[model samples]
Target chain A: MTDSVFLDSIQPLFQDIHAHFTSQPDLNPQAAWDELVQSGFLRLLLPESAEGAGLSVAEALPVLMAAGYWALPLPYVETALLYAALPDALADAIDGNLALAVGTCGPGEPAQPLRLGLHCLDALVTAKDGGITVAPVSGDVEQGWRLQGEVTPLSQVLDIRLLGTAAECLQLAGAMQRVLELTVDYANTRQQFGRPIGKYQALQQQISVMTGHCHSAVMAAQLAAGGMQRSNTGLSLDHHRVAAACGMIKAACQPVVSTAHAVHGAIGVTEEYELHHYTRRLLAGRLAGGSESRWFEQVGQACLDSGASVFDFTLANLS
Target chain B: MIPWPQRQTLPASAEALRSEVRAFLVAHPPAAAADVRARSWMGFDAAFSQALGERGWVGLTLPTQYGGGGGSAFDRYVILEELLAAGAPVSAHWIADRQSAPLLLRFGSDSQRRELLPRICAGELYFCIGMSEPGAGSDLASVSTRAVPNDQGWLLNGSKLWTTNADRCHYMIALARTSGQHGDRQQGLSQLLVDLSLPGITIRPIRDLAGDAHFNEVFFDNVQLPHDALIGAEGDGWQQVTAELAFERSGPERILSAMALLECWCDWLRLCEADTGDQRTLGELVSRLAVLRSLSLSITAQLAQGQSPVIPAALVKDLGTTFEQDIPAMLADQIGRRGGEHGRVELMRTLAYTSIIAPTYSLRGGTREILRGLIARGMGLR
Candidate 1:
């Protein structure tokens, strides 16, 4: 059942959605949100009994590809994952009636903790320690409202709300792929010394390395996702596998994205151009998960536990 | 857009298989006395391999009619994981069971499969790759080996370098130029199954850094093969060899080479935690290892589904080799500088051995450059 939807419905939807976003210049989160809501993008993962598309993981990959391609900045993903557990009234608010924002509590807090006493809601925020919180809100006209904190850089904040750490990694990987493709295309089409720059072995080598990075990043994402999915399915996920994927992703994506920026040269970092958006996202995404150091520690422990052999560590975990 | 599950799911039977392999490893660890510095793929213990065969573990991926267990790819993957993780001496049967048998199953003539599959399944026959020559390591088309057609069969001439286990193998699948000129790198290249024990073939052992005779230089002078000894057909060697490499480059072996040493270091670290100051370094290593394993397992899953995933496979080999090589050096840095007792000093020595040998990790299957080229081509960069 899941396989069919993935091959038929979601795959096509993803391709179409990606093409739509790629061709469009002004990709606004607010506008994307409206289109997605109207198209039921937000409800694909939710159960059909709950008025959602009720797609499984395989079926929902297209949605991720769409989000990744457009670099869409909406909290659709966070909302979808957390929707079932949300309070009844909050859930109602999220049913296309109101826009919602959800954030995870920091570490050492209770599982699923919610921060209460926050403003910008129809009702006061309430929570059990670390539980997810949903607060309904109205426009600025509401009384007794006090701004508790300012969410700066609306664009960046929008990305955080949409992707979380894991999705952010995926987005960075996708962005890196896009950048490589663009750079290669540019190198081939741009003429230099009576031929395309790609004709030069030096430039080809650089592009080749960039391509390697992109490949590594994709593998890292796939592996990380595979581990997380295994955990969800009640299989013991090798912590080392997760850490290694995270480390590789961090290691590979940063350099690849930066090299791409370097390859694009002056024009890449300019504000007027769109390439900076991806570069910025890639930079920001790297920091979202524990930094390289943090992931490196995780990887080290896994290696040590498996007794320092890649074969042993992996085989033991798999077994 | 909704996030993909981002996790791999293995069959439940894998757990049972793991336990069985683990028990086997505990009961019969590979002979530690043997040169520990041999390349993991080239290092082998015939006794240990036979033990595995006795338990029906050899050729786990082959059909039961051919003395195999007729298991799924996951089962074979589990077996390999266990064998490699235990640092078991599987080198003796590694190529035969891992690539040769599988390749023959897919592409060899019926007689070839029937003749070799049982022995491979029983760990009685060993095979070596006669692909690389002195001049042609990654540029396979540069192979100078020549096979001349005769009425009876074909006569192969030339030498293969870096032929792992060639000295001890029963047979070799030699890739030689069958018809095309030296300029035609790809055309007329064909794979011929040659008996290593046949006259006119000589094997000279090559001692590696670890002081182990893991690889050999195999010289073939007018070595004759039966007409049916050819795998696939004339001028089909490039395709056959490429497919075979896809098998070789992909698999648990690519990622798990340093797993045993990593495990040993972990144990040592635990014993010396009090003196190590903080465990933060160990924690980081563990995380990195986890991601590598995850990436490898995901590739295994893809392979199980019959997807070649060539680029991803290359990525796994590259990243995996990098980590494998890094493990010994990183562990040495942590332990070598310290003033330690006799046992601790010996441990450091072992780690040092691995460190020196690790550099070849990327060079063996294909160099980092070759892998990157393949990856670029896969990504349409070429």
Candidate 2:
């Protein structure tokens, strides 16, 4: 009888993401990606008249959360955000033949050549020089000393990166939740000392700590999402608050991943076990947009730079 | 099973209500200084509470028939969040506005609502929780307080320890043993509205480490009560108390317990020589607070939908208290490493006060150990 319209609406997508986890050796998420795009999952954050879901990031968070929960291997979040940030890339992104990769550049950082759209990626967008530019994925570019792919110059990718970062946080939260659930189930079933290991108070405490980390990660993701919800509010989106939330989520990945594995012990590393499906994604997600430390430092720098009263600044900036 | 938190948004109309709260808080400033702001909700000021009542801010969510504003949860959330952020002394009417009025509206007899709710909404009447006892800590069902049925009313005989504001509150919603003895985890329990002014009831303050007596030992020795004092059906205290915690655990109060200090500490950081490293620490805390507030708001939205979200509520309290407790340590380290001028010294004094009460933040509502267990049970680990 509970009114879960949001979860109820996204249940099919959640099942679709789960259905992608097959007995296949490789996690081929291409099929699921096409299905989601066809279902307009990629347009969730866009405005209503644009054939999008017309929902804010806050409302779209459950979809992102589900993507991670099933360890869906597709870059749906990045694509959706790319479309939201650069509607010009919508056609290519929707085609599924060309995936979008978002790259971030700091002040005065030179344009570096890299493999952004690694798998079936034909287009690359980078934020630099205070402008957003879209470029063709220069053919297999070089790495270090080897010429592997084309090096394309790009600029103004910060907003897209922010979107991608928030997406990563959502996915990471979902994966961590799955890990906690799986580990707890393992503890209940795995026998030790003539009983389920979960019966021990010490282990229970550790699992509890892992649950806390997972919960915090989820909360941080929600915050990041809420910050992005300012899209159509007529109120200028406070990037500082959104960025800090992203930073918190990125930072939380460390503890969440570590505690999850700790609770699982040696079995957590085994390939056959589904735990790594999420842990591996969580780790890669942490590194993709930006590491936790980078974001934390940025948050700190923003606070210091924002003048006078930090309290007033925080109140005004937060969603 | 703990239902997945129903994701909802702050409707545009509700978001518009923030300015009203901001305006109200600005007009009515706190009477205390920075040092006492560290106490957060524990700082009591009946005058301030009554001022809010006059504006119909108190019991903002209760029905208009009971002198309430007949508002949504968001209206109440905005007021409470603003008050909490300012470190306003809300203790005088905190219990009544937060839990008591809601409890009575849900389970209290119709007569009880007509008689006491109006005064409560006016902030003239206050109530305290009577759940914990001398022997029962987190195992609340172990309460030994007994209410024997008599010709006049139930004669209450027992004591409730750690009863917050028992010394000052007008009444207490006590959980007592009605038909079962000790060791009955939750059976045969009942919730009774025992008036503290009645004979056979004693309120003794127990000063904490910070030299404050927010918690006290409430003794009810054969306390006489009228038939109307029983809140709802007898022997349903366990279910009722559990319902009460849904309101208790999830709120801005859980996280705001140490927020005033955090805000003050943020201001204190500016006074320092201001290193990027220290600024980043402030940034870390800010992000944590902002994110936690979002989750808290989500829980509030859940309550508006009439759902019990106990597991998530417990989870929020556990994580919230952890963050609340950590604020002082982080500030103390920063202050210890880089000494500043008067603002830093003031922050230090506030830290001294905040640090002492920090232990109780996680302990008071429900200890971390107990809350974690609840989370574990929600995860099917138990």
Candidate 3:
């Protein structure tokens, strides 16, 4: 049944995943990782030859988005996508969570934060010396690492980075959507001056703007996903996909977070409220795979170099 | 949840049709000057529209029986985006092709469809919407145009304000009060197919701030019409017009109104050695445009599926117009900051014209406030 099920049928499983995480908010990292492993989601992109589902990356996009929506703290994106990127023998050698860490830090600068730093991971994939390297991680061996892995070319690394960025875009989209819903629900129920605040024009206008941001973010993520599906290679990088991912991050990140919190007011920041989980992750997602501005510069510089009109450039690169 | 339809690309067939449109554009490029082309869809040329009709480009989504291409909505989207990007003059058949034919197809009597759809598809007959009036702008239901039933057929005895291209249009799809008094809001409203050449009807053009006379004030003083002029059913105008606005709102025209200006700006940028800041600005606009194009195309996909997604259409119009209006503001700031060194004749002219006309992006179709309110209502916030 898991071999080729439609997304419609898979939705209930996502809802169940959300429910499971919600019910056990304080669960340990090991237990949460175990739940994801039992869910059979990691086999989404594996081929049928390996006794796996053999689904394409396009088909597995919703799963990544659902993981983000639920704020599951495991390295689900890195592990799931790494399955297809790495050879079967190398992939099978890993037993626990696999986290992807980007950037090559110099001597003086502090290392960038690992997105899934708190998770129970078995290896770390890093971009160093213009190539991708994987290092095994053991208990409490967090800070530094010795050379103990094979390296892949920059092009292959870009493929991985693009896929990771697209995943981050979808994640940001899901989180922003949740944040918008939370704000809307809050506005409808929270009363101020004899009526729900949603009844006020000012609040309605602000929330309406927030709705545009959410919708655009979702559209951008879907664009990125479509771009991924259209590319010939498994984890290839396309300019359209990169631009769309950046667009999604730009639209979904700060604009959504600020508006959601502004609408929720003081309660939004408290640990008790559920809004912060999604909002905090939205900010992290914006910075994680690459900030919006970084990708925008690359895309922009290319457009300038092409010497084509914006419409012509966009039609050529994106369409 | 706001149901933004999933992103979709034009099918291979539609992409193939794109080359056809490009060839047509190459053969007959826009004859207007840079400043005039900056008007985009609002730039009217009857000969060009009729030429497109000859190629079956007009009314592409209509049936072949009515002289249309009988193509899918994607076909129309490809044609439209190409036209708007090249700043082609489409105003002559834009209304008739975009919404009028679709509205008539959905709600017109068989005779009405036979008579008007063919001519509209052929680009021989033009239409102007008569929904807005001097007394009614965003509040469309309050329109006071009355078409009283008379012995001949029905007598139209009111006026329409801001009626775009009314002076050139042969017909006006007037939303008049047929069965109820004013202040009844949406009740008893009816749509009538009014011939612009009828006796006692007069059309006078109104010049915009940019000195363009695209809009008109049309008056109907006891003008006679046939009994078959009523579109759809009586007292069903409210629901019918609501459906038509969905077509009017969700389109590439909303986003690409300033595209000509953007092209002009880019051409100038290519000549001069633009810095990283300028490139980044251009890239930001491109990213937004790419996403918006994706969103609009997705909505078009939904349209092809026979769904009238009014709420999503409204949301696109709101966001699209905001993007449209931003081009002029941002580019004008660049001109301002650069001052004398950045002076290029065509670019400056296009920029000035687009800046002058940008305000109407939100004002037309629907106001920003009204669209946001519609979105809020769709979100169940009202």
Task: Tell me the whole-model lDDT of each prediction, alpha carbons only.
Answer: 0.63, 0.74, 0.77
Ten consecutive residues with minimal summed lDDT in candidate 1 chain B?
A: B1-10
List candidate 3 segments past 4 Å from native.
A1-24, A92-118, A138-161, A229-234
TM-score of chain A of 1: 0.68
Candidate topping DockQ: 3
How do the predictions measure up, each by TM-score? 0.81, 0.88, 0.93
Tell me how far the alpha carbon of residue B15 in candidate 1 is from the true structure, in angstroms, after superposition: 3.9
Error of 2 at A290 (Å): 2.6
Question: Tens digit of lDDT per residue, candidate 3, span B87-202?
Answer: 89999999999989999999998888989998998888899999999999999999999988988889889899999999999989999999978989999999999989889998
By DockQ, the better pick of 1 and 2 is 2
Could you give candidate 2's per-residue lDDT for residues B72-140 as a string of tens digits?
A: 998788778778877888999999999999999999999999998989999889999999988888989
Those runs of model 1 whose alpha carbons end farther than 4 Å from true positions after fitting are: A1-32, A56-61, A84-89, A92-163, A199-216, A219-248, A295-319, B1-8, B32-39, B274-285, B305-308, B336-343
Q: What DockQ do you compute for every candidate structure?
A: 0.27, 0.46, 0.53
Clashing pairs in 3: none
For candidate 1, the per-residue lDDT at A111 reads: 19
How would you encode candidate 2's per-residue C-alpha lDDT over A58-115 as one tens digit per residue?
A: 6777777876776665566666666666554344445443556555333344333221
Most TM-score-accurate candidate: 3
TM-score of chain B of each: 0.93, 0.96, 0.98
